[model samples]
Structure formats: C-alpha cells, structure tokens
Target chain A: MKGKIRSMAYAARHDGLHAIRPPLMKRIADASAPYLYSAPALILIVAVMLVPLVLGVSYAFRDIQLLNPFSGAFVGLDHFRALSEDQAFFRALRNTLWWTGASVLLQFTFGLILALLLDKPFSGRAIAQALVFLPWAVPSFLAGLNWAWLFNPVVGPLPHWLYRLGLMSQPANILSDPQLAMWGPIVANIWWGIPFFAITLLAALQAIPRDLYEAASIDGAGPVQRFLSITLPFLAPTIAITILLRTVWISNFADLIIVMTNGGPADRTQIVASYIFTQAFKRLDFGYASAIALVLLALLLAYSLLIVILRQWLLSKD
Target chain B: MRAKSTFLTIAHRLAILAYIAFALFPLFWLLKVAVTPNDLLYTEGVRLWPSRASFEHFDFVLRHSSFPVFFRNSLIVSGSTAVIVTVLSSLSGYALSRFRFRGKYWLVTLMLLTQMFPLVMLVAPIFKILSPMGLTNSLTGLVIVYTAFNVPFATFLMQSFFDGIPKDLEEAAMIDGATQFVAFRQIILPLTLPGIAATLGFVFTAAWSELLFSLMLISGNEQATFPVGLLSFVSKFSVDFGQMMAAGVLALIPACLFFLFIQRYLVQGLTAGAVKG
Candidate 1:
C-alpha cells in the first residue's frame, strides 16, 4: 500500500500533472486510462445496485406499497414503530440467531474435520476431495428442495429410515411441523455450506509450514499438543475471518428457508432475510420491508465491528 | 504405536468415504427420482435405487413441458451476465491491479461495501426503478441486474489473477514501442485466460442460482428463469415429483459442469469474495 502511494506521488512529480514537456492530448490519455477501464462497471453498479440501495434506505422512512398507487407518503418512524411490536419480526430475529449460529458452528466444525482429513497425502484423495466438495456446487434453492423432499414421507427415505431407527414415531414432513421446521433448512444449509468452509480452511491449512509441525513432533509434542500449539495458532486468523464473514453472509442467506418452508408452519423458519422477502414481495409492504432490512444492516455492521475489536484484542494479548 | 497408526489410517479413509456419501447422496436421489417412472416413485421410495428406472421424466420434461423455455431463458440470462460481467470486471480489475490512480481507494471501498450489504434490501426499490423504465418482466432487465450484481466480486477475482502476473511483463512490452493499453491487450490478457475462464464460470453459476429478484422482476411465465420457472411449477403442479426432480437435475447440470472445471481455483475466488451465499 505504501509503495503504491509512493509511486503515485512519484509519477505526479515526474511524468504526470506537474510535467510540462508532454503533449496535452498524450497527458490527458495517460491520466484517463484507469478511468476508461473502470467506468463501465462503476456506472452499472451505481445505476443498478448502489442507487437502489440508497433508495431502499429512504423507503424505510416512507409509505410505499406496490399495488397501492397512491401510497408514497412520508411516514417517519411509522414502519420502525410497527416493526418494534411485530411478533413475527421478533420471531424472525430469534430464528436468524438460531439459524446463523447452528449453520456456522456445524459447517465450521465439519469443514475443519474435512480439511484435516484431506490434508494428509492419501491415495485417491483428489477424487475424494472433489466428491465431498460437490455439494457446494448445488444451487441453494435445489439444496433446499432436495432436502425438503428427503423429509417428505412419501417419496423420501429419510422419514421412514428415521422411523425405523426409532427416532421418529411416524414418517412425516418436518417442514410442516412448526417446532421442527427450521431444522429442515438448517440441515440443508449445513450440507451445502460445509464444502465452502472445507475448501477455504483447506487452503489455509495447506499454507501452514510443514516444517513447523515436524519441529513440534521432534520436540516430543503429541498430535493433540501439536494441533493446539501449532495448527490452532497458525489457523487462527483464517478461522476468525471466515467465521465472522460467514455469520453475516449466512444470516442474509434466505433461499433454503424460502424454498423449503416459505416461512410457513407458523413462521418457524422466518429469519429476517426471508421475512424481508415476505414483506416486500408477498405483502407488498416495501416500507416495512426496508425498515426491517435497515435493522438487519445495522446488526450486521455491529457484528462485524465486534469481531474486528475481538480480533484486535486477541492479537494484542499475544 | 504401529497398531494405533494403522487403525487411525482406516478410520481416516472411512471418514472420507462417509463424507463423500453424505455429499453425493442428495444429488444421487435427484437423479434416481428423475429416471424413475411415475408409477414406481412411491412404491420404491425408500429404496437406494428404483427397481425400474426409465428416462420418461426427462423425456416428458423435454418434449412436453415449459422447462425447455425456462432452460433457454436461464442460459441466455446467465450466459449474458457472465460474459458482460467478465468483460467489465476485467477492465476494472486491471485498473485495480495496475494503477495507482486518484480515488482508487474509494472505488475499492465502494465495491467491498456492495459485497457486504443485504441485497434483499434493494428488491422493492429496483423494481420501482426498473418498472418505470420498462425493464421489468424482461430478460434484458434480468441480465442487467445480474451483470451489475456480479461485477464487484468478479472484479476482485480478476484482480487477484492480475496480481499474480508480474507487472514487468507488461512494462517490458510497453518499453518495446508498445502502448500500455496495447501491451495489456496483446501481452497480458492472454496470460490470464485461466483466470478469465474461472471468473466466467463463477459468475455464470451465480447468475443461474439467483431467485428472489427474478421472481419479483419477471412476473410472467415467458421471461421466467429456471429458478422462477421450477418454483412456480412446483407450487402449481403440487405433486409431480418425477418431473420436478428431472428439471432439478437439468438445472444442476450447467452449474456442476462449470464447477468441476473451476473447482481447483475456488480457493482464490472464495478468498477474494469471502464466499458469496
């Protein structure tokens, strides 16, 4: 970063704006190269995404319903007021916590194990790695549908198998049972998401110096001791960053819940993300939806800040 | 110690096999159901393989369903989005990699900020904005939205690739009587062919999987992408497990094919974007 800055100032002094010998046309062309390269992408993002995001934030302070033609009224805090008392929204918030917590925890644990397993130089490990990572390629909606089918009693084997194993009293669709509905999507998410953690953690694991482990072993360190003293410390930054980012990312991920349950069976699967979809699309209440989204955005930012502070604190302790 | 090491090796292999089975089982079920004739779908429901399997479901979906249309629409949308995003991101990513220009910091920050926020927030507003311009309920609209959504991460992915190549290659070309732009085009972009392919495949899969906006923006059956089409078919038809599973398998084909091709570089791509969900 400092090198880039130094070069910028150097170019400015020697060959850029301060130089007098260069022709006007040549200088202009030289200065505008990066702009010309980047303008197309920047303009599209501004027009499509960034502009809409600002508008969406503004929508939180107004009354905007899709079907109601005369509904663009300025209603300050009315949406937020309604959101505070909405039991369903509160329920969705709690569900978001449960969903993000369980999904990240399980995905990380299994992913670390999978990475550790693959780290060894074993025969046919390449094919094994590919096969195990295949689930991450399955689109989120299909993952939901596939798992939802598995939970269905008639066509799927899961319910019957669980029944045979005496885990369930009968073959049933857990998706329609409010108490157990969230697990349906949560399980699908774990299946789809495990590969992500595995791939990334594997990359980090491979980058760890092999000699460090050799040295630790030669120093009479056992497997668990070496893992704690070497692997854990080596992998800590990657683990922290991945965990923090995945938390926010998964909380915003609503496709599995939306496809599987649509927040049904008494809204058991209604996280804030799917709730935003439900409000904006189903109810056509853009205002309320944007308000909920604003709250979610704030929460995610706060969470990210918290993680950054926690990371800094841990680093300072060492 | 030898006996314990031998047991650990067996356990490790068993664990790998177990994970592979768990990963492939759901996909296997999708294929199994797709090939199973409707009559035996329920009778052989819990069986690992259907007693009688046929391509009747795929046949019916291809010959006599709206799926062909959905498949074509998905191809067009995802393909266009991927190509367009690759082109745009390549340019921006090149700038990010090679330049020390003004406002570069802000530009990078803007792109990163876009990656972090909830895109569901933009649904209603984008609809409102696009509808007035008559872009809603159109494939062109879907393509534009998808292209924009993908460009930021694709840019980062492309930038990482550019970063890997030494700047001296382009500089050497520039000093040998070639302009910087010409050198970048003739000498540098060719070397990043693998990165470009990886970016294209990555963006294509992302555009293919998008659901919410497509559902919202494209209201009619004619413009529906695969996700919207398959979803509506599921809700409307309600019980054609054979056909739905067949279509699901078809939807899986393109993404998985591209996935297999680019699986090796996923560490780079995911690290760049921090894993888009």
Candidate 2:
C-alpha cells in the first residue's frame, strides 16, 4: 500500500510538470509572435536601408569612387576637406534654403487657402475638389516634364504671354537664362507640391468639430474671428508637423530641378540633393558625394531638433 | 448684410474657379499638345484649341518608339513591388495594430526616421552594393529598392486601416480555435479589402513614378522604366515635342486610373493618419 501511494504521487507530480511545460512554451511563443510578424519587414529594412546607410556614412570617410577601381582606401576626413573648399557646394546649400523656403511657404500658404475655400459646402464641391487635387496624381517626373514643356518658348505659350505682359524682354525660355532659371523649377515644384499640402490640410480641416464653428458663429464671431479663434488653433499642430516634414522632404527633392534644368544655367538651380546626384553620377566621386550628404543630414537633424525644442518651449510657456 | 454675404460667396466661387484653372491648365496643355498635329504644333502658337488635332503622334509613339518596352518594364516592377509591399506591410501593420510589444515604440520611431533622412545619401552606397551582386541594371533591383523605400509609408498606412477594424471579430475567431494569424487571414483581411486596394494603388503609383533609383539601377533600354526611358528619349530626340508629349500622356494613364481608384479613400486615409499623428 505504501509503494502504491508513492507511485501514484510520483505519477501525478510528473503529469503536473508536463502540463506546466506546455504553457511555458506557449507563453514564449505568444511573446514572440509579434516579433515574428514584424521580422520580415524589419529584416528587409535593416538590410536595404540601415546597412546601406551605415555603409554610406563610412564612405564619407573613405576614398570611394564608382569608376575608379583603386579608390577603396580609407582616407579619414579627406572628402570633408575637399568639400570645405567647394564653392559650388556652398552655392547649392544656399539655393537649397531658397528652394525649400519658397516651395514650402508657397505650397503651405496656397494649400491653406485652398483648403479653407473647399471647407464650405457648395454645389459641385466634390468634382471641384477632385479636379483641383488631380495635379497631385500626376507623377512628379511627368509634372516636371509638363511644366518644362510649358515654359519652353517654342511649343509653349507661357513665355510669349510673359513677354506680352512685359514680364520678360522677349519670349526666350526662362529655363535657359541663368538669372531666371531657378524660378522654372521653383514654379514647377510649387505647382506639384500644393496639392499635397491641400490634401493633408483639408483632412485636418474636416476633423475640426462642426459644433465648434457653429458655437463661434452663435457667439457673434465673424468668419475671420471664428477662423482665428477656432480654426487656426486646431490647424496649428497639423501645420507645424506638415511643414516640418515637408521642409525636409522638399529640400531633398532633386527631381524637379534635375528633370527641368539638369542643374544648369550656370548651376543656378543646383540644390544640395541635386549636387549629391551630380557628384555621384557625373563625377563618380561617391566619397565626396557621401560627405556632402552627411553634412546635409547633420543640418537637417539640427533643424529638426531645433523645432522640437521650440515646440517644447512653447508648450511649457502655455 | 445679405449683399455682403452674396459678394463673399461670389469671391469664394471665383477663387475656387481660379485654383481649378491653375491646376488643370498644365495637364490640359499636355493633352492638348499630345493630340496636336506636328504640322500645327508650333504654328498654332499656343492657341487654346488646335486648328486640327490628330493622333499621329500617339500612333508613332505606340508603333515605333521603345516606350512600349519601358511601359511593360514599369508595369512589372511597380506591380510586383506593390503586391510585395502590401503583403509584408499588412503583416507588420497588423502586428503594430494588435500587439503591445517591447520594441513597438522603437519600431515606429525607426520607420519615421527612415522618412526624414535624405534618400540621396543612400544612392551611391546602394549602387555599390547592388552592382557586384549582378542586380544592377536589372528590373529586379529596381523592384527591391522601390519596395524598401515604399514599405515604411505603406506600413503606417496599413496600420491605420488595421486600427479602424474592430478587435472583436478577430477575437471571436481566435476563441473558435483559429490562431491569430489564421483569424487575421480568415476574418479581418477580407474586411480590409478597401484599405488593401488603396495601399496597392498608392504603392503602384509611387513605384511607377520613381525616377532616381530607376535611373541609377537600370541602364539598358530593355530594363528601363518609363521615367528613365522618357528622359533618355528626351535627350536623344529633344526636338520631338509632339512625340514626347504623347508619351507623357501615355505615362499619365495608369497613374490617373489608380488615382481615380483611390480618390474616395484619399481624404479618409489622410484623416486617419493626421488624427493618429
């Protein structure tokens, strides 16, 4: 009887342990499930973006050139040294500020106006919204080409109209003149980018509680007053974030300038992003290009940090 | 007060009209020039309507140019990238939406960081890495690069869609002995078809419009996507405005179609993103 009881107890204990093991294993599996789901994307992003990013940063310090086979030696800070003396790099930097500033400011201003105009209900609003937003759907490259064609005096009417309005001495292509060349791409950038701002702003605009507007109006708030009291405050966060993101994005946008001008007319339109492309593609100097890119990356980070700090300060002040 | 309101209304309509005109005029000119006969192109001198419109340019572009090959290549790259990105992002997005994990915050931050950095920084490095792997100058290379670049935004987009779905449906399926993945597939995935379609369309247009990577990765005419091909065509035949515009119109077709497909969802998607953001 003692042996029998002892054996039964042992069996029960073993079975209990066995039961406990499965849940532990199951717990681990459950814990890892999210990671498993995200693993593929994470791996791809790491391999394709992160690894290349690190390698690119390393290239900033190394002598790496595409066409030159013997250019793999590590030359610390040599590219940066060269970049310090590159006048064109400085010019491109300034132009980037101009391009980004003008593009973002104009896009945001117009986008806000367009969003407000579209906010009210009207007949044919849906079709009007779609039509106005159609430009966003046009591929950026095609937008570039279309605008380039529009600015061409030979086949386009813009130059002739400008001359007729006395905005130009003659119907010469603005793209070919160094003084006016940057505007060609800037105009194209504005035209292509406005819809992006409009779409996002309109979304934010729609999210404002209808009751808020009604309340303001009931309080004898005129349109401008209501807009100031309610709409601006609601739109502020969206505006700040969008502008911050878009400033970085448009500064890096080299497509329009590249397609339209190739950064020519004495390189008047060559922003840093396009300059990086020109260096890598035209010069085959990957190291130098990477260096310029690193500087740009640093500047952008600093700008972002400043914005964050400013935002925190404002919040604290409030 | 009524007179003031009336004037305001008129001004609003006029302003909207002006914006519509500004937005459409460039695209309108593209279409206008595409159909204008070569004989009348310059001679028409910016006439609102051509004296005579012809499909001669389109006919030549379709029959003679290498645009057809570029179009096919672009279709293959973009279609494959869109499918792959949507599938992968759906999984990751689902994880992000449903699961509270240790690294979730960091993952989101990492994805946002990817958006901020200048992609041009990666151009040379990516080229160097791909060239030796025999992936350079191939459509597969373009697909891979484009897929990586687009997945981050698409993931956020898909995550928003997933958030819109109620958890009860999937939970019920799970209680019925279906695994989470199985529930996601069987119950939740079907309901998110609109979101999937929107993501697909968005990624497709993005991949189709990509210029920099395609230009860098693909060299030969056989592998050249539309943007690169169109650019090369421009350089080679700079004087062929009619033909180029016709090709431009051709390129616009798929994008516009995709736009129309996703137009209804665009505002909703942006709103969801903005709210979450």
Candidate 3:
C-alpha cells in the first residue's frame, strides 16, 4: 500500500511537469512575437529612411552633383561655407519663416472657427461637413496648380474679381510680382490646409465633456465667458501640438511654391525647401542641396526640442 | 435670451454657408473651365457659368494625350502602396498596441522623427541609392518610398483602431486552440475592417499626391505618375488651358471618391486617438 501511494504521487508530479513545459515554451514565443511582427516595418524604415538620412548627412560634406561625373569627392564643409554666403539662401530662410507663420496662423484661426461652427448640431450638418472638408482631399500638387491657374490673369477669375474689388490696379497675376508673390503660395497653402486643422480641432472639441458645458451654463456663464474659460483651455493642448507639428511640416512643404512659382519671378517665393529642390534638380548639385537640407533639419530639431522642454517646464510648474 | 439665441442661430447658419462656399468655389471653377469650349474659355472671362459647355477637352485628353497612361500608373502605384502599407502598418501597429517589448518607446520616437524632418533631405540620397540599383524612374521605386513615408502615420492610426478592440476576443480565440497570429488574422482583422478601410484611403490619397520624389525619380514619360504627367503637360502645352483643367478633373476623381468614403470616419478615428492619448 505504501509503495503504491508513492508511485501514484510520482506519476502526478510527472504529469504536472509536462503541462508546465509547453506553456513555458508558449510564453517565450509570445514574448518574442511582437518583435517579430514589428521587424518588417522597422527594417524597411531603417533601410529606406534612416540609411538614406545618414547618407544624406554624409553627402553634405561631399560633392555629389547628379550630372557631373567627376564630382564625387569629399569637400569637407565647402558646401556649408558657400551656403553661408549665398544671398538666395538667406532670402529663402526669411521666406520660410514668413510662409510657415502666415500659413499656420490663418489655417488655425479659420479652422477653429469652422470647427466650432460645425460642433453645433444643425440641419444639413453632414453635408456641410463633407463639402467643407473637400479641399483636404484634393492632392496638394493639384491644389497648387489649380490655385495657380485661379491667380492667372488669362484663364482664371480671381484676378478679374480682384480688379473689380479695387484690390489691384489691373488683373495682373500676383504670382509674377516679387512684392506680393509669396502670398500666392501662402493663400493656397491656407486653403488646402484649413480642413486639416478643422478636422483635428473638431475632434478635440467633441471630446470635451458635455456636462462641463452644462455646469458652466448653470453657473451663469455666458457664451463668451464659457468659450474663454472652458473652450480655450480644452483646445489649448491640441492647438499647441498641431501648431508645432504644422510649423515643421509647412516649413518643409515645397509643393505649392514649386507648382505656383517654381521659386521664381526672381526667387521671391523660394522657401528653403524649394531652394533645396532647385539645387538638386535644376542645378543637379546634390551636395549643396543636402547641405541646405542639413541646416534646415537642425533648425527644425532645435525648434521641436525647445517646444518639448517648454512643455515639460510648464507641466512641472503646474 | 430668446432674441439673442435666435440671432446666434442665424449667424451660425450663415457662417456655415460661407465656409462651404469658400471651400467649393475653387473646385467648381476647375470644373467650369474644364467643360468650357476652347473658344469660350478666353472670351467668358469671370463668367460663373459658360454660355455653352462641351466635353471636347475631356475627349481630347483621354484620346490624344498621354494622360491615360499616367492615370493607369498612378492607380497602380497608389493602390499598391495603400495595400502594402496597410498590411505592414497593421502588423507593426498591432505590436505597438498589444506588446510591452523593449525598444518600443524608441521605435515610436523614431517614427515621429521621420514625420518632423524635411523629406527633401532624403531626396538626393535616395536618388543616389536607388539609381545605383536601377530603381529610379520606376514605379516600384515610387511605391517603396511612399510606403516607407506613410507607414509611420498609418501605424499610429492603426494602433488607435486596435486599441478600441477588446483583448478578450483574441484571448478567447487563443483559449480555443488558435494561435495568436491566426486569431489576429481571422478574428480581430475582420472586426477592424472600417479602420483598415480608413488606413487604405489615407495612404492612397497621400501616395496619389506625392510629387517631388516622383518628379525626381521618374525621368521617362512612360512611367510618369499623374502629378508629373500633368505638370509636364502644363509646362509643355501652356496654351491648352481647357485640356489641362480637364485632366486635372480626371485626377481629382479617384481621390475624391476615396475621400468621400473615409470622411465620415475621419472625426471618429481622430476622436478615438485624442481620447486615448
């Protein structure tokens, strides 16, 4: 009887071990599964983006002009030195700031109003929402071209309308006038971009709890007062993040400038991004273009870091 | 209070109308010019509607020009990029949503960093890299580049979608003897079809609009995407305003269709993300 009980206990222990081993193996497989899933995307990103980024940085210090067969020599910051003196480069830097600032400000302001307007329930809200958001669907290149045509004196009505409104002396294309040329792209950028802000801000606005608004109204808060206290605070974080991301995005956005002006009518509308393109494509000077790109990259990185640190400081204070 | 509220309501309606008009006016003008006969295009300056409209420009663009080829190329590239990015992003996004692995934070950071930098920086290097491998001027090259560029955002979007799904559904599947991969593929994926559709639409529109790399990489007219072809046509035949506008309208069709399909989901998806964050 003693021997039989001992054998029975051993047999149970053996069965428990068998059950535990498969699960241990399964856990190991499970733990590594996420990495396995992510590996393909990570590999592609590294191969296509990260490797090229590193190579692009290296190209900044070398001469890698596209057309010139003999131009693959290490130049050691020669492109940078020349960039420091290029008047066009300085002008482009200024234009970039102007373009990004104006575009962001207008898009955000109009977008906020639109978002607030749409936030309220009304008849035909669905159709109104779809129609208003259509521009975001238009391809940026096409938007650029379409707007360019609109501003054209020959084929478009904008110039004619402006002349009628006494906004201009004649129905001349503002795109050709160096003085007001940058506004052409800036306006187009705003028209193409407002829907983005509207969509994002509208989403954020909707997420604001309904009870908060009810409570505020119960406390005798008027529309303006409620907007000032409740709406503003709720929209602040979205506004900050959207503005930050858009600043970086718009500064690099060259499609409108390229399509509208080709950085032309005497380089007046040439932001740094278009300038980089002109160097690489028109001049075939990849080395110089990469150099300009590097500086732009560094400035953007600094800007992003500054925003992050500022946010952290504010958070800590609160 | 009654008077003020009524006034506010009127103001709101008018405001919404104004916004809609501002948005649609440009597109309407594009269509207006596209349908205007060649003879009427210049004569009817500033006319809201032309005296007579014709499809002559559209007919000419479809039969006479290389636009058909360009359209086909764009469809191929954008369609492939959308499908491939959705698949890859679904996997990576699943990893992000479900896993607590090492380097996950860094991976997210890397993806965001890609979005913040000027893509023009990579233009030269990509050309150099791809040219050596004979990938430039090829549709394959464009697809690869666009897929990489779009995956980051699509992944984030997909992750939000995945987060909305319950973990128990997959857990129960696992408990029923299905592998996790099978569960993800057969169970969770079908439930997230709307999210998948949204991702597909977003990536499709992005790839469709990409101009610079396509312009740089494709030197041959044979492989030119819609943007490149339209641009080249504009520059070469600057006098054909009607044809160019017609072609522009054609280009707008697919993107608009995709947009209409996804617009309803846009706010919902973003709200999901905003709430989670």
Candidate 4:
C-alpha cells in the first residue's frame, strides 16, 4: 500500500512537472485534494448534524419550550432532578432494556437460522432469499402500523387466530393490554430486523472456506461438532460487532413503539427514546426532552465503551 | 445414513419455506386489507382472502386524496437526497479510498460519531436552527438533512467500491499526464456504476423511509412526505383501515422497487462498512 501511494504520488508530480503546473503548486494541490473532495460533506455534517447535536446537549441545561418564547432561560439540573423523581422515566429505562434485548435476541436467533438454511444452494433459492429478506425493506413506521393492525381484532386476523388457538380467552387487541403491550413493538422490530442479521451473517458464512467444512466432514466430524468448532468460531467476530452495533441502534430505535402504541396503555411500551419523543413533541418540552435524550445517549455510549473494553480484553487474552 | 441426510435436506427446505412465509405474511396482509371491499372487511373476518376484493381503496387513495401530493413530495425529496448524497459521497469516498492525508483519522471519527449518536436528540435543536432560516416546513430542508445524514454511510460504501477497483488504472492515467482528479473522473467513476446504483438505491430507500425528522420538520400537507402524511392520516382517521393500507401499499412501491434493484449488491455493500461505527 505504501509503495502504491508513493508510485501514484510520483506519477502525479511527474505529470505536474511536464505540464505548466509547477512542482511546488502540484505538491500543494495534491496535499489539499483530499480535503477539497471531503469539504462539502464535512461542512454539511457539521452545520446540520453536529451543530444541532451540540445545541441539543446545551438544551439539556436550559429551559426551552416550543410554545413559550420566554422559556429559554438557563436552568441547571432542574430537568435532571425532575427526571430522578419521575417514575415514567425509570420505567422507560427498564422498558428500553426489555425492548432492545428481546428484539435483538429474537432477531439474531432467527436470522442466524435463516442464514444457515440459505447458505446451502438449492432450487428456488434466489426467489426464496428475496422473499424472506423482503420485510427489511418495509418502512419501519409502516411495519409498526402493520403489526399494530395485525394485533388489533377489529378487522385483522392475529387476535382471532390466537383466540382460536386457545392462547387467549377471546379476540382482543394486545396493544391495549399493558402486560402484553410491549410485545407488539418488539415483535415488529424482530420481524423487520431479522433480515439485517441474516444478510450480514450469510455474507460472512459464504466467505468461510468451503474446504474447511469438506475437510471437517472427511475427518468424521458431525454437523453439530463442525458448527461448534468451525462455524461458531469463524462467525464470532461478525456476531460480536454486529450485536454491539445493533444493540446501540435498537436502543435508540423508537419508531415502532411510537407508531404502534404511542407509549400508551399506561406507558407499558414507552422506551426511553419514545419517552424523549413524547416530551419533545407531545408536551413541547424541548429542555426536558433534551435532558432525557442526553441520558439515553450517555447510556448508549457507556454500553458501547463497555463492549469495546470487553473486546479489547478478549483480544489481549488471545 | 442416506435416509438421515435426506431428512436433513427436507428439514432445511422446510425451514426456508417457513422463513419465506413468515417474512412475507404481513406484507401479504397489507395487500389483502387494502384490496378487501369495505363491506367484506368487517362481515367476513379473519379469512385469508376476502369473499370480495376491490381496488376501490386504491382508486380512492390515488384519485380522491392528498396522497398524490405526498407521493410527489416524497419522490422529489428522496430522489434529490439520493442524487445529491451519492455525488458528495463519491467524491469524499474516493478521497478516503485513495488518499492518505492529514486529519483523516478525525474525519473518519466524525462520520462514525454521527452514525452512533441518537438523531432523535436533534429534533428540537434542528427545528430551532432551521426555523430561523425558514428551512423548516420545506422539502428543501428535508433534502438537506437527509443528504447530510446519509453521506457518511454512502461514503464508506463508495470507498469500498473504489477500493475494489485497481489503483493501477488511475496511476496509469496520471503517468499519461492526466491529473489525479481527472483520472478519477474519467477512469474511476465509470467503473463504479454498480456501486453508484447501490448507493443511490440505499440512500433513496433511507430517505423514503425517514419518519421523525420529516414529521418534525414538515407539518403541512403541502410539503409532507408519505410517512408524515400517512402517519398523520392514520392518527386522525384510525378507523379507515382500507384506505390506510392502500396508501401504505402505494408507499411501498419505490422502496420495494429499489430493494429489488439492489438486492444483488446488498451483502457486498453493507458487509464492508457494517463493522465500523
């Protein structure tokens, strides 16, 4: 790679010297080229995303209301104090754990199975693969609404089917049932997210050398044994990184909950992210919303940091 | 042993079939509800296929509602975002792919940080920032935000594409007296067409599916994207299942089309950057 860059750089200067461009000017241009290429994207990200991020962090320290013009005063620690006493916030924190955990676990488990099944070539594999991966293409809010419809007994089928199967006493909407409400969004999330894991793991699975499996079989290793000793070990890195990234992403995902239940039925499905949205949009409490969002952000960062440390430690052990 | 192997093969096929059914059932249901006649919708409950089906809802959603406007706005916003993002990211991605320059580490980190942080945090502040500049409640604002949000991932994707192409091509061009940028434009860009298509598809679907930001930014029906329009419509008229699903099936068109177009490259494109933040 170093030699490649050097040769490219040498060629660049050679061209510069032959042309009207001075070698000094050529060197400066080459040095600034990457920056120029990246400048537009960088400027947009900073202005639109990063600036707002910093402002949001500051909003956590101030009292900012959407409707009130006089509500932008600096109010240090008040929102945090209210947050500490707020039961809804604590419940949301717990619900976030439940939502993210169940969604990721179920999605990964099903996704891994699907990937393994598809790893082998067969008739109609292309069509089947496309069909099975289709759900990931559904817009998330639509997915949530679709699932909500399924659970609703009015014109949908799931509740009726569940009742007929004796899982429920009668056909009823589970989203209105506090004990079962969170399941609505979690199920939607699992359905929507499974293909992500399946696709990634399938790619990783296909990359594994075919000869290794062939060799394992020739050596009299059973399917289960080969999976344990070969497949599992090979997939460890992708699984770890995928799970870590997915955990953060899922925890911050509130679209399903927001769409399906809107954190209703006594707030059973209200994860922290959804709670933040409610504060920001419903109550128009920008300051309080920013405070909650800050906490969620901190929690996600801590979780990511912990995973990084764990990964580093594991690497060191090896 | 032969029987056991045969049984395993059958089991695998069965498992795949089950997955296909599970993945497609809800979308099928969406279509089913959309087509079921309103009278049959309530009278004949829980049937896989209603006794009578109609395109009445589709007709209504298309001809007699605000959906056409929402559809146009979404296409405009998503298409513009996809095109703009693809262009910017190609340039940035090529730089990242070929050049080793100062502050590259920080640039990569900044992009990574944008991906990690909860964008829901930006709701209030982004609203505040855009409102002052009269960018709020406009499709242009949405295009700008979506473009910025997607650039990082698209850049990484484009970088992977550039990485796959041989560096020799560009070097040869430079040796022939073309500057690096010219070589990149004339030689490298044409080779990455599939990559460009994949990036465009990826960004289009993302922008198409964006919910909260558009919901926060666009309040009026005039500028509302499909998600915002459909969501607000669902909330206001919760009882209109047939019409809602019809609108939904309509919204699914561009995304599903893009999905089909890019399915071939999905794994290759994502696997390269999926590991990073």
Quantify all predictions' global Cα lDDT against the true fold. 0.90, 0.89, 0.90, 0.90
TM-score of each: 0.94, 0.94, 0.93, 0.94
Fnat for model 3 comes to: 0.76
Alpha-carbon runs more than 4 Å astray in model 2: A1-19, A304-318, B268-277
The superposed Cα distance between candidate 2 and the true structure at residue B254, in angstroms, equals 0.5
Task: Give DockQ for candidates 1 onward, in order.
Answer: 0.72, 0.64, 0.59, 0.64
Candidate 3: where are CA atoms >4 Å away? Answer: A1-27, A306-318, B268-277
lDDT tens digits by residue: candidate 4, A213-305: 999999999889999999999999889878988888888898888889999899999989889888888898999999999998887787766
Cα error, candidate 1, residue A275 (Å): 0.6
Say which prediction, candidate 1 or candidate 4, comes out ahead on DockQ. Answer: 1
Return the TM-score for candidate 3, rounded to 2 decimals. 0.93
* Model 1 misplaced stretches (Cα beyond 4 Å): A1-27, A305-318
Q: Share of real contacts kept by model 4?
A: 0.70
Query: Which runs of model 4 end up more than 4 angstroms from their true locations?
Result: A1-21, A305-318, B275-277
Tens-digit lDDT string for candidate 4 (B77-177): 99999999999999999989999998787887688667778889998899899998899999999999999999988998999899899999999999999
- Could you give candidate 1's per-residue lDDT for residues A126-237 as a string of tens digits? 8899899988878788898999988989788899998999998988888998889889999999999999999999998999999998998999999999999998898998
lDDT of 3 by residue, A1-318 (tens): 999999999899888878898898788898899989998889989999999999999999999988889989999989999999999999999999999999999999999999999999998999999999999889999999999999998988999999999999999999999999999999999898888889999988998999999999999998899999999999998798778777888899999999999998998999999999999988889999999999998999988676556545644766
Native-interface RMSD of candidate 1? 1.3
